[model samples]
Target chain A: MMVVIWGVVKFIVLLVLLSVYVLFMTWFDRKVIARMQNRVGPKLIGFHGLWQPLADTIKSFWKEDSIPRGSYRFLFWLAPIIFTTCAFAISFVVPFAPPIKIAGGVLHFSVVNINVAVLFVFAFLGLASFGVLFAGIASGGSKYPYIGSQREGAQMISYEIILALTLLNPILMSQSLNFETIVAAQTHHLWYAFYQPVAFVCYLIAMFAVSAKVPFDLPEAESEICCGYFVEYSGMKMGLFPFAQYIVLLVMSAIMVLMFLGGWTGPFWSGGFIAGFIWYWVKVAFFVFLFTWAWGTLPRYRYDQLMDIGWKILLPISVLNIFWTGFALSAHLPFF
Target chain B: MTQIVFFILSLGTIIGALGTILCKNAYYSAMWMISTFVSMAGLFVMLNAPFVAMLQIIVYAGAIAILILFVMMLMDRRVLNNKERFNPQYFWGIILGVGLFSDLAVLAFKFRINITNAGKSLTLHGSNTKMVGDVLFKHYLFPFEIIAIILLIALIGAIVLTKKDEEEAR
Candidate 1:
């Protein structure tokens, strides 16, 4: 009963955190990008537009919802909900810290500590592609959205294998699929990043690909497809679409921290709940910052280039890394 | 609570299955199939198979379903126009489905299932993953290797079929 209650409380907290993160990330992206272009961004409403994300949220909520004629109404509406919910739910199993002793001596973490938490996160992330595909198809648009959806679907599917294989390296090192076990393993030795550099790089590339960031942002390729799959979306609908993207970003960063960064492991701090929480956030924020920085520095890849990097470069490397990790583990070598 | 979850799961799976057959557009059908896959996975979790449930979502719902959807898109079939013709087949499909369901129901009623009332909940034993791996590599080794070889052959065959045809056309 305590576990159930803790789960509910954690779910609520995580949802609120994700909602705020999504809103602010949008504002941050806009402001950062604008500054890069030597212009002030979102400076109108609140102190250099600090309140920009909130304002945008309100505007989206108030905007008239429009459904395209001949669109499949059920699927069109269902897409965003599935997309956002799956994005939100994966965080439930992810440990933000060591379990906390709460009222009545109930032990709790951010979410349920499933044994297969790592795999669950990947599985949920994989579901997000369906939302994009459904959104494109249900729009009943010309060939452009279809083309965009096709690209997005193919890109996601291809990158997903690499992501899983890259993740397998750390899982092999820890000899467990549980997120908590992976973190606990890291406390004894160096982080998995030291040994699995190839996997780390592959994961980083795949993360960018999955997030549809610069170079891999083929789904929303401007100049050619015009916002690509989301061209037809408007008002709160578009807001939901970007909201899902931010959630994906947060979840991906969180997973990266858990799998590679020795989640919540810091010097001088005992592996308590508060310590774990701080470490988890710090690592996630660093990665999020890295994602923003990459957005500024990197140019978008050509469609063919993006596909080539995914299939030709990252996929093979990840496969090789998996084998190497497996061999190292079997031979009792210090792989991590 | 379990019943409530089961109800929701069944509703989702049934609606998704119906949508797969009833929808005019192939893309929409594929989306519904994905929904069915995900909901079925939830059922698997409810049955205490979290690993299998995750695999179902990751492999089938994630990779395989999307692959099918992509192939459907690539084929560019005029799905909306063909709905009228496909409607007649649905009646036969439903009859066959009902017949199978009833047969399974009768079989299930006839069978006596013996379940041990273990006082303890199912817990994963230490090195369970290793045990599974050992079984796969030892007893099932030949079959595993054969499957890998078969997959490789099929992959090569596909590459030959697609690549050579494109070259010949060029």
Candidate 2:
């Protein structure tokens, strides 16, 4: 009973922290993108728009929430709920820092430490796309939203293969699915990124594609499809999509740090839990910034082009990388 | 506590399955099917098969359900509304259902004692994923490789069929 209660308390703390982090990322993304475009962003709010996300949250709550008359109202209502739930679910397994010892027991930084953490992330990642697909269909069967959902379905199915295959290289090296074990394997030795650079690069590219970021944002291209899947959504309903997207972005970045960047453990230092926690977020923040930077600089790909790049380029490369990793391990090669 | 969670998940799975059959909209039916898949995954987790549960979610709820929804989305509403009074599939569906039930009944009767022993052995393993890996790669390597080859053949067949359609369109 005590263990269960402690777990609940830990999960609650993680939830609050995740919400605050999402808010900060929203503001950071806008500010960074604005600077890249040579324009000031959200300066009228609190302290160079540090509180912009909070203001936006309040404003969205006050605005009128509308459901299209022709839409499937139940699914319209359920879409964001499911999407947000799946997004937050991925956060449950993320090890924020190394385990810390207190008076008698050890305290883990993650909310829940499951053995199959990597597969758990992949499972929820797939379910999140389901919620987006549902949003497309439930939005009064509109043409643009329908098209957007089609793109999402196809894109997720393709990119997820590469995502799993790329991560398998790291999993092979570490010999464990738990995030902590993966990080522990890299603590003394080199990071898997150094050993499996091909897989690392491919995973980074697939990360953006899986999250539906700028270059692969065909699912919600505002200019082309008029905010695609959530076009009919208004107020907080619309806000929830981007909110969920940001959480997914954070989760993916954290996973990238965990898998490839030697999560929470910097190469230079051997500091304890507090430093590890800070290091984890610092690496995550850099990856988050990369997403926004790409958003500002890159152009969105056409639907066919997006599919071509995923299947033709990323798929073959990921497959070959997996084989190469397997061979290297069996042959007892250096670094691997 | 475990029993309570098991009860809730079982209820969800049954409700979702019924909803999938009864829902008028194809998309809504697909949603119910996905809900059913997820509930079954929860049940699998409770049964100490986290690896299988995750694979179930990733494959069934994630990939296959999305494909089903993708096809359903493009389908005309008129096509979904069947004018016939009878579903021809009901006969075969019932027959197959009864056959499956009888098969389960026979297995239950035959392996009632062995099932308990198997359950105990399952809990003794340190890691379910590693155990499954060993079984697949070492104990059942031939069958596993055969399944993989079959899946690969199906994939190539699908691509070849699709390529022909694209060329004809050109």
- By TM-score, the best candidate is 2
Residue A126 in model 2: lDDT: 94
lDDT on C-alpha atoms for all candidate structures: 0.80, 0.87
Best by DockQ: 2
**Residue B117 lDDT in candidate 2:** 44
Give the residue spans of candidate 2 off by over 4 A. B81-86, B95-126, B161-170
For candidate 2, write residues A155-257 as lDDT tens digits: 9999999999999999998889999889989987888899889889999989999999999999999899988888888899888888889989988999999
Query: How much is B126 displaced in model 1, in angstroms?
Result: 11
Fraction of reference contacts reproduced per prediction? 0.74, 0.85
What's the interface RMS deviation of candidate 1? 2.3
